[model samples]
Target: MPATLNQLGLPAVIVVGAIFIVWFVAGNELMRRRGRSLAIWSKRALDPLGGRQAIQWITLHSFRLEIEGLKPPFTSGNMTGLVESWDVPITWLINRLNGRRDMVLVQLALRQQPIRGIELFRPRSLLAGDARQLAVQEGWTTEPFEEFQLAAMPGATPQRLATELLAAIGPRRADLLRLALRRRGLHLTLALNIPNRQAVQPAELTGLLQGVAAVALRYATPAEATD
Candidate 1:
């Protein structure tokens, strides 16, 4: 019996190894599909706002996945006019993995517009437990509206300006803003107050934000023309 057991050990190890490989591959693929689907869905949802151009920008600037060691992290960004929001899906995922069922801080951001209000609806299962309670207990408030003055280079349209801004700051947060607005039935443009807020003369804040957006956009989508 001992001799027989020893002989089977190698085959058992091989089977276990095979199973692990399959599982890893499956998990990785699943993560990729989920990320892509999220990006597509987000883009479609925002398509009505500014047409295909808006959709394209949103899709291009949307979600990103970061895996550190064995843990996986997901972040989504969106710009509603000028207000950018970022969703960190990883916190919820991590909490779920640890057996906590509650909506974590899935979205956070710094914006140049006032957050009228925030409401979390139909949170995913991973973010299901005590989200409302947690939000209330923590007294979460969106960042205050900031003012920026950007110089319109030559003939920069509103869309061009928006695109330039997004380029400066990696689109992950901007995409999250888009998702938040959709979920809350809010208008992205109104939230950011783009028209009224764009100052004629450049200021420290606007200059900084625009500069950052310019650099980031160049890095993320270098070939895209800008005004």
Candidate 2:
């Protein structure tokens, strides 16, 4: 071994190890705090929907939240949030550099259906490719909507449906990655990083969901009605 390397090795290693330990612990604590805040925020966001039961979990890089017992049209909702990558410095750096902020996968089940199928997506979202492919395979007609891609079951949905749905989303439309009307219910994917842990209002979310449901109901007509 070289004299200079051997001379300082053990002490240097100990110091480096201590720093790593501190970093890991601090990162974990930060994640825990964020998780708690999110849990509270989620409860508030779901309360108006009569969310009677809820479950939450915290992990190294994500938070999972689910709630049930919603009001009419919605039976349940679940959110899968990817927001705590800070526990791993490398991953955190990469995510930030890519302009990839945290996001939530929101799945909502409805008690009824307004239309057979529909999909709206922000074309720049990471999930855009998959949504597009699914639309094609399902034989849905696709069209452009400013910065979004809109698709609907050819004979099952109205041409004005897209306009109404976007209007329902209101000013927050830009943050939406995808809005789908499936056989069972609706799925909304939203980006939650920009406002960085900002508390979401229950009334606001409730309103958004209700507005979309209202539009869906308005378009629930026979296939020939769309023609």
Candidate 3:
């Protein structure tokens, strides 16, 4: 190595590492586009690197999260997320960056039909951002829970729905974000925050998705009715 760099030692390494991380995190996504694409880009950057880490056994597991809302031929707006779960160092960095919220694979689904009414549940103070104000403007009431605050449309019952949702989600889980929509029914935002230094079984992730879906569907309207 260069004598100057060698003399700098750890400080030089830190500087070089920071620069490399920024470039890698930005990748082609940021330079090529603007706004949200950069966020998506970060996920993309994680993919191959995390995959490589997995192959080399540097990380426990990796997965690709792709969003395909439209079932038909039209491929208008699709997005993907790449995550390396169970990497202690990466997980710690991510949590610190995301306001200490447990890092997890957040999966969201929005439907067209309004099941009963809006049912929203959020923490007393969200680390992500402020709770959505759209519903509140249109006349939703906020009901406080033991650890979370729920906001539902005027006619909707927040307290009761929260009970049902909690019962469905079970205990010993990570953070959650629940909200309602206009005619869009009860949208869902569920995640699995557990990360460990071991391979994640496919069946395990499958079961988690299934459990989340079960809770979400309770407020979902039939497809025919939605159409």
Candidate 4:
């Protein structure tokens, strides 16, 4: 019996080893798809299986990933954006299974901030009406209209700006995105959500967001906003 048990263990170990290697390699590939820069913070912890999980987070947007390690401020120059990535495998898996999505949120510095009133233009899927985001959800009202709904708080929706928004959305990509304008920055969300992170295209997302930002700039407050 002892000899038979030992014989079975050898084959079982080989099969388990192969499975582990595949999982590790696939996980690494998914983590590295964006070509992240050297991590400002790398901490080692336990993985789901209670094994070693080594992960790093590159906080600053000052330097590019092409360069090795950290570069001084003189060489790195001005920072364009801040990015934070989560490499928790369990959290990623849970979000996929639960139908939750988290895409990159970009907050680019604006030359001028928007006013108190906010205009929310949403795709047809959502209620196309006006409501102040700061106000209580129940207190809000929606007067559904057009291809894209224009909702505003504090006053009537600006038809001129709404027209511009409609033009910005255009015919081709109108259905795929939603735009929300606040006093300081614009928030753009993708209506299409995929289960896997690797399926997301960073370049496409960045381009769409930049286009939206450009359109919003026309309405920017002429003077710098006071804090």
Clashes of each: 21, 0, 0, 1
- Candidate that scores best on lDDT: 2
Task: Highest TM-score: give the candidate number.
Answer: 2
Order candidates by TM-score, high to low.
Answer: 2, 3, 4, 1
Instruction: Name model 3 segments beyond 4 Å from true.
Output: 1-64, 69-102, 105-114, 117-130, 154-156, 177-186, 195-202, 225-227
What is candidate 4's lDDT per residue for 147-218, written digit by digit as tens? 445556434445565556556544424333245555532232223222233443344443444555565666
Question: Runs in model 1 with CA error above 4 Å?
Answer: 51-124, 129-227
Error of 3 at 68 (Å): 2.6
Model 1, position 137: C-alpha lDDT score: 47
* Whole-model lDDT values for every prediction: 0.31, 0.67, 0.42, 0.39
Task: Give the per-residue lDDT of model 2 (tens digit) for 1-227.
Answer: 69889889988999988887787788888867766666666566667878675565657546677777788766777876665456667776776664455566667776655655677887766567878897887788888867778887665344577777788888777567777766544443333332355544646665777787777666554323233
Q: Supply candidate 2's per-residue lDDT for 34.
A: 68
Give the lDDT of residue 90 in candidate 2: 77
Per-residue lDDT tens digits of candidate 1, residues 1-227?
99999999999999988876776566555545544544443334333322222222223223422111211010123322111111234543564454332111222122222122232222332222343444354454322122221221123242343444444434222211211211122112111111111232223223333344333333231232449
Estimate the TM-score of every prediction.
0.32, 0.71, 0.47, 0.39
lDDT of 3 by residue, 129-223 (tens): 33446545656666666666666655435566666666655642443444333344224444433333123333444344445445555555665
In model 1, where is the ten-residue run with the lowest total lDDT? Answer: 66-75
Better of 3 and 4 by TM-score: 3
Question: In model 3, where is the ten-residue run with the lowest total lDDT?
Answer: 49-58
Report the number of backbone clashes for model 2: 0
